[model samples]
Target: MADFSPPDDNKRTGQRGAEKSGRVADFRYRPPSQSKPQKCGTGSSAKKRGGGKTSIPSPKPQGSAPSHHHRKQAYAALDLGTNNCRLLIARPSGENFTVIDAFSRVVKLGEGLAMSGKLSDDAMDRTLGALKVCAEKLRRRNVHLARSVATEACRRAANGPAFIEHVREETGIVLDIISAEEEARLAVLGCHILLEGGEGPAVIFDIGGGSTELILVEPGGKVPRILDWQSVPWGVVSLTDTVGRCTGSRDERLARYADMRRVVSESFAPFAERIAPRAECEEEIRLLGTSGTVTTLASLHLELPHYDRREVDGLIVRSQAMRDISERLSGMSLEERSQLPCIGNDRADLVVAGCAILDSILDIWPSERLGVADRGIREGILRSLMAADAEGERHRREIRGA
Candidate 1:
């Protein structure tokens, strides 16, 4: 299946004034202007300056919408990773959801942390600022329930708890630094809908800015049992920084890509070996990829002059096509890549590193076609929240009836 792209028809309605309590009241705010949030420390100063003056409107609660009498309950999820801080608010409609509003910003929370093993002051400031914005959005939407998580950057940082406290104080958002196991599970959950009909075991890989997560699943099972999982410390941002300093010729660049492939393969070897035997003999062994790399490749394969979520999500790219795209990306200079519609200036430099990581996963799995998923941790968090709420409601009704 192709990557998943939630429709963008969710419109904002309601008032835009501060409540009598001096807090932003219930309002339906629109999605942030950028598709992905800016990474921390990079352009945060400008954003902070501009964000201060930006208008934040409010939205009516679900049941209050006049036209939609049977309005579905709303839920919200937030994911703060090494590189990005994202939030999604949605209203469930049957099995799916209509995203009411979404926000994403690249905070690069893990920036320089790989080398220093600590979250920098500037990075924390940037991330906190973004979180503050998210908190306001949640308040405006009156998000009844939400879950916010921090990933590798926080997990590895020495002052992670202190950082979380700062977030709570500044944004009124609690940040949970999830374990690697939970990270793998959430990744699989995000991709579960796409793997419904796949044969044999399906492998899902997510290459993030600070880490990579791989989850192997046997299809058609109650909660696809995780066959094997692994989290590699290296991600696009770190790998690119390492490679950029090497100073190589064209041949060296290719060689560096090869080296990257080897590094990832080595990290994934044990898990890959366990799954490879089954994958080879099975007809349904397939790869499902989530993250910026695979999506960018899908966009490039479609020859999109610009990044279009509708065109790239759930689109299948053959192994050869993947290679072709990787090679084309490797050959381009940062300036050249920045010009590509799918790879903007912000991602142009890191895209190749992401491609390298992806190539390694593909090489290890050797799947005929890769399934794409745009959803990830945020979706998983939302699903969990909704389910918990339903369970709670059911319990309350049962007690009342009794």
Candidate 2:
């Protein structure tokens, strides 16, 4: 394995905390870049604007393999983040890994962390139960190489270290608390392949439950060089906590959402100065987003009956249309947003916070098209492990030849 650790430090899966606005970086700005979503999608199938790519789909449910294959070894990646615990079990194929099984559950581990620096007992219990499921899956799969990680919530909570100890005792799974820089690197590793074909710089973002990561990359070959990356401490859960749930009338609700956006935009100010000029570079500036926020918006844009990763993954939506949906959702009361088919009570409040964050990104990047990805750290971890497995094989072959 390529030591999943970066030169410094770093660390999602399908299914994916709590910090205030001023912690990550303290800066603010209102740039004039005309940030807007140029296209949006609506239909029975996934949305496809002109120039975008969907991710490689998970193997079919009936997918199977011979047990005697020498080169194929199953690997597992478990991601325990602020809002979700997710597991991915996969085997290396030619260029990609085929998933054998996957598990995801919303644990809301950082639900109130923005207000309280400690992880609440209830949240810890919820996350522990989810981890138990993940641990069982990894053990049964007999994973060859596994890397489990805990993100922002674990990085911020006062009881985070204690919780990590408890998780190992209860589930026998060890989690590494990664740094913000590493978080941005893995996210780019996982999704930069989907960036629109262009010589200009592209922005890839992962809107996590407790924080948001934005990476600016200048496309080289297949991998993107991390030109500059920023991690803002405001995700769906944390943002909602910072800017209270929309509890008043329609106008009041919109006002609250606006307040949330302001907070997020302030955090992006420092980065905005560096990234804003790239919009006019004339190379091919595009934006790729991987997070629950993008996935949900892609679903609403597609008007699907329910959330479908197959359809939503890699879908490109109009920046304007996404903002429109966010605007409408922000105007609705929590009860009304919850009633929507895709977003129920549990996600009702958080979705609006996600919208605020997305809007801020759109304002900063202003890409006509937005790419939505259903994969992140989990896929990145699997990719890295598979690469090492292949490298080891080649090295052994060379030794025999020598």
Candidate 3:
């Protein structure tokens, strides 16, 4: 097994005091690109873009046994969000990890949480079914280290802990309902590599289903420092529920989109003010985004017939282009949206809300080009797990020499 050390040197995930002020601890993280993994080429490998089938990479030929080293080092990350259940299983390969298996399902776990403030029975059932499949994949892949996390839906739900217990009892998966601060940190850790090469200050954001996170970053050397971050309780699901749908005539839809943007702007006002001076001081502000909204919009920007992570991931597009797409989508009727190739029915209802949130983000940061990333928390988790294993191995070697 890889002997990576646990990331104890990293800052605490708790948010209070200084953290509450939008400032976080100076955490150190060496990205996989900066450091080589202990073992290379051990294993071989989306979005819960709903209204689609789960994607599983083709496996090795039947009856072919994976190498023992691959089995011992395989790691998995499960991200159970308000709208989706996604899993990634991989092993360290050179500077990065090679994904062996993956699964994604749109469970809509927080479907009615805005009104009910609880995980609905139906939502739970849907999510559990997804998790069952993930469990099977994990077992089949022989995952040696795994981390499962539940986001905003669980954090805000009154019955979240109980549901977590139920999931554990049913599937043997323990979920860590992380803090908003931790969520922001993990996202930055995962996708910062995609930011267009620049040393000037930058902002990276994730527009999630139940919440949106915006992080102001100070970049210099290998690891960027977190200047500030904020998590607003307005994601595609929550925001759509609050703002209502973009229904009726074109004028009405435009009004609804404007309203959504205003709401998000107000929520982001304080953070925007805090970072205003910093943005002004910097020569350039690079922007990167990791979420369904960015990835879907990127696909649209590319005019792909279907969603392709290979083409979308790490792609950069003009900020004006994204805003244009957002406005166009906001004007389209629900049925019109459902017919789009990358959107389909599952994401049609929520994509407008996402657009509104993104538009608001643009108002604040106003970067020229927006870098899109299909990777986020799960990739961050995999890197952390593998890095820890590598660190552990180095320590053991030191002990042997001593």
Model 1 TM-score, 2 decimals: 0.80
The TM-scores of all predictions, comma-separated, are 0.80, 0.83, 0.83
Clashes of each: 18, 10, 10
Query: Residues 1-402, candidate 3, lDDT per residue (tens digit)?
Result: 122221112232222222322222212211123333322111110122211212211212223233446435778888999998999888766455677798999889888888777778788888888988987887777677888889999988888888876666566777888877878877877777777886678999999999888888877644467778888888898888767889999999998888888888888888888888767765888889999999999888888899998778868788999999999999999999999989999999999999999999999998888888888888777766666555556566568779
Alpha-carbon error at 15 in model 2, in Å?
A: 29
Write the residue-wise lDDT of candidate 2 on 64-130 in tens digits: 2223364377777787888988888887664556788899999999988888887888888888888
Superposed by TM-score, candidate 1 places the C-alpha of residue 139 at a distance from the truth, in angstroms, of 0.6
Give the Å shift of residue 261 in candidate 1: 1.7
Model 2 segments more than 4 A misplaced = 1-70, 396-402
Task: Give candidate 3 misplaced runs (Cα > 4 Å).
Answer: 1-72
lDDT on C-alpha atoms for all candidate structures: 0.67, 0.73, 0.76
